[model samples]
Target: MTSALRVLLLCHSFNSLTQRLYVELRALGHTLSVELDIAERVTEDAIELFQPQLVIAPFLKRRIPESVWSRLPCLVVHPGPPGDRGPSALDWAVLDERADWGVTVLQANAEFDAGPIWDHDLVAMRPASKGSLYRREVAEAAVQAVLRAVARLAEGGAIAPVAAAATAQTWRPSMPQSARCISWQRDDTARVLAKLRSADGQPGVADNLFGHACHLSDGHAASAALLVTLPPGAPGELLARRDGALLRRTVDGAVWIGQARAASACGEGKPFKLPAALAFAAEAQRLPELPASLERPDDEWGELRYRESGPPGARLGCLSFDFHNGAMSTGQCEQLLAALREVKRRDTQVLMLLGGDDFFSNGIHLNCIEAAAYRTGDSAADESWRNINAMDDVALELIMTTDRLTVAVLRGNAGAGGAFLALAADEVWAHRGVVLNAHYKNMGNLYGSEYWTYLLPRRLGSDDARALMQRRLPLGATEAKRIGLIDRCVDAETGAKAADFESGAIANGLALALSHNLAQRIAAKHQARAADEACRPLAAYRQDELSRMHRNFYGFDPSYHVARYHFVHKLPQAWTPRHLAVHRERGTAA
Candidate 1:
């Protein structure tokens, strides 16, 4: 009980929750191993090989086998309040617009999620998608609950079983199409948004677009300004299009649908969740396209937006890109590049690249690339090439800029090429809770080309940079700062208060812009960039990196493609990655 628990994580996939728990457990000095919950046999094999003191199911689709839980101490993280049971916990919460929710870590039992209570954390709900809530609030609460549960076990405390519900209301059944189905003619904006929010990531709400059967997702209400352009149309009629989303008329107002999955292509356990505009390409073109300005109404939805703040002489620019799941496709990359240029042209003394609060970026869109593979004359390989190159362009703008300081302000998690992209900034300010997977080897040994060769080595130096690249693990914010991967955290980097973190950091950032030595700092940055460029041009580093990436895209090795395909389609991994399954290593306990 005193020593670190030999913990084994059994998850459906290395999702956000699992990844957060892995990072947390590793940081807590626990010897950890991870195994995908592929099948009952595989889970048994992991248990046999790991001989773990505790098993944690952070995320899973199916229930754990009775054989294992009966013999071993195991905990399952359920995304629901105590007594609220089912696979569709979050879905039901969003559908019913529950005021609050909870995450429970309970001992595994014969019945699904009906285990003895260990610990739980509760919080009020936020207006966001199911995926966003899962990553941020629920995931954070689960961490606290799991940690508390482990401590409780360490204390040899007797945990009590879940109490019986007073009514049948606590029972959450698997939502059928009838439940999430949208009746555009009858459902108001609030009702429509709730349906879309509940089914954001998985089996989306059933609806037909362009007279074709499809499921709708990524919903946002149409901005008031956009209402002026609306024509007299039926409730279910498609009114206009913008930023790859379709504006559909509703009973009271319109809602913007960002993505969809065609029913016919739902076979073979494949997914084709494409941009709503792309999903109905032929029909979309027939509708009028709406143009949105970079600076618009606050409630409006757009992936890339720009805002300038602070006093006149020393102004700050915040360029926020809230891309869905932080997956940047070729077009998104280009859009970001153009936006960066526009923002740079302004007279702001500092620029903050504020990516979404849920995820900064996970690199190129694998789903987009996977969708590309099915189209005529298009290959996932080619999409990879274009997307990476476009990403490089955005990174280049960050690296080459010398007029003002650039800061990558991360409010959420960042991975793969996205981690490197943040490095292109003069400094990076991350939230205390941020987790960064700064390596690319996991994604089929991706060499990765976001000028990482030039950026990482310069920041961390050659030896440590190479070590980090090969480590194949996530770096917590504190550890990342210790390793010089980031500049500041909740603490001040530019002499700002860290009490409110992001807000305090932003206030301090403006102070940094107005600092007396700001000009000197900018001059030094410019000189340093010029010196680096002279020694090894960014183009040279980029060309070298892209040369290797070209092979990853077009070469004989199909590892990247295969890995990406499974990842995009949400395929269950057959085996745990060797890097994560430390128990399987020789000389370790078996």
Candidate 2:
């Protein structure tokens, strides 16, 4: 291994990719600091302050300052292969249905993405949304390429570019709404899905419903079972609603548009992405309602799902909750709790909680909570209170399930309240590529609830738990396993279905069925729960946490509200938080 070097990360946001790289680089013993891409001068200031040996722009929205990069070695992570030069590299790849995609670590120079490639990984593409593609393949590739580039930089060597890509370049412009536009009357299911999936996360495809304009996102190809039930209307007309998504007929079949934003939110008001049903509640109410049970077909799309396998004596119940972007609202929490309670009463010996592949859960739905302020009688505070309480209730149910071995299977990422909720399980099984943001204070000093006060202390002792909570750092799966934050971190797996909660549990369902002392272990689990409950009622821990959260919600200080607004509206960062911008730390040598 090469020696560690001082590195600075400049990104548009501390997104999943950035956080993953942060944890990875830190684990490798590199001295790292982060600076948000606020402006060119801010970039220059950070460079001067840190005086870093190298800089990595994992996810920048704009060009880096030439002044700094010309003087310092900077590597830009492009979510595309060598020779690809554009803002919408991944977007164009998805839209054009490329067989393979890649992540390139290139030297930052005069011409963007035309720099010498330090390393790159070209892999087969999966049929997924832009967001899913970014989180999974794009992220993993970038990590590998970036690690290699950094190691090469540490060891004395001459960097070079691949001859094929350096000889020529393909420059694609940023995809616009016009390019992503769907001609419902002409486009078939395949064409429609490609368009929607290409722009799933940002600058969603412009469309209309109920004679009102809206932007479509988080789409799923309608399964045969669902399509058979839906009665087709006009090509563009919505035929049914289920699980907060609206089912609309395409030229040939239908697709489930999970989330949307109202056109009215575009011009004067800030647009919020929400469940399609909620976005057009009045219009959606008039549509045909599609009912789906937990035991529905695996191919069907829904927010929650459940299945039972294995023998009667040692049955395994697998439950999945695939909330959009893993942001669980109050309704989603309640539904999940209901499912958990139902499965708890079953004769299963193990319950696997398989969260979505893109994101396990980031916590409560900030966009939905922000939307509450626009409703006639709803307040954001009330919605927040309801969402957190519902989350707490779900955590309580998991904590109380002692008869079965509960495992939180994290295929993607988990953060905030969701991170603690995973701790509610008997064990947390994480994918090797998974990232966990195990703190809540980053969100404008939120005193999070979700039973973290009780859960965190048990795994990590009181002092360690308190320190972890205040750290506000994202933990890699390996680091978390080393620190005992997670039970197991397994190798990465192949691609899973998108938006459909259809992936199986990871790490062989944590070998729950094969344990030699399964019964005794369960008995011990019961005893441990009983002991903890007797010492301090679970309700007390909840009350204390919620009491602090109450101050964040209904209290005089509006930090939480301000943070939520900026987050939901995708506002530009005024300044990097002191926690991440560590160059601002005192007593630093010049």
lDDT score of residue 412 within candidate 1: 80
Writing each residue's lDDT as its tens digit, candidate 2 over 72-95 gives 778899999888899999999989
Could you tell me the C-alpha RMSD of candidate 1 in Å?
3.1
Candidate 1 clashes between residue pairs 3 or more apart in a chain or in different chains: none
lDDT over C-alpha atoms for residue 27 of model 2: 90
Angstrom error at residue 288, model 2: 2.0
Please provide TM-scores, in order, for all candidate models, with all chains considered together: 0.95, 0.96
**CA displacement after TM-score superposition, residue 67 of candidate 1 (Å):** 2.6
lDDT of 1 at 570: 71
- Model 2: lowest-lDDT 10 consecutive positions: 493-502
* Model 1 regions lying over 4 Å from their true place: 155-169, 263-271, 491-501, 587-590
Distance from true location, Cα of 568 in model 2, Å: 0.1
- RMSD vs true structure, all candidates: 3.1, 2.2
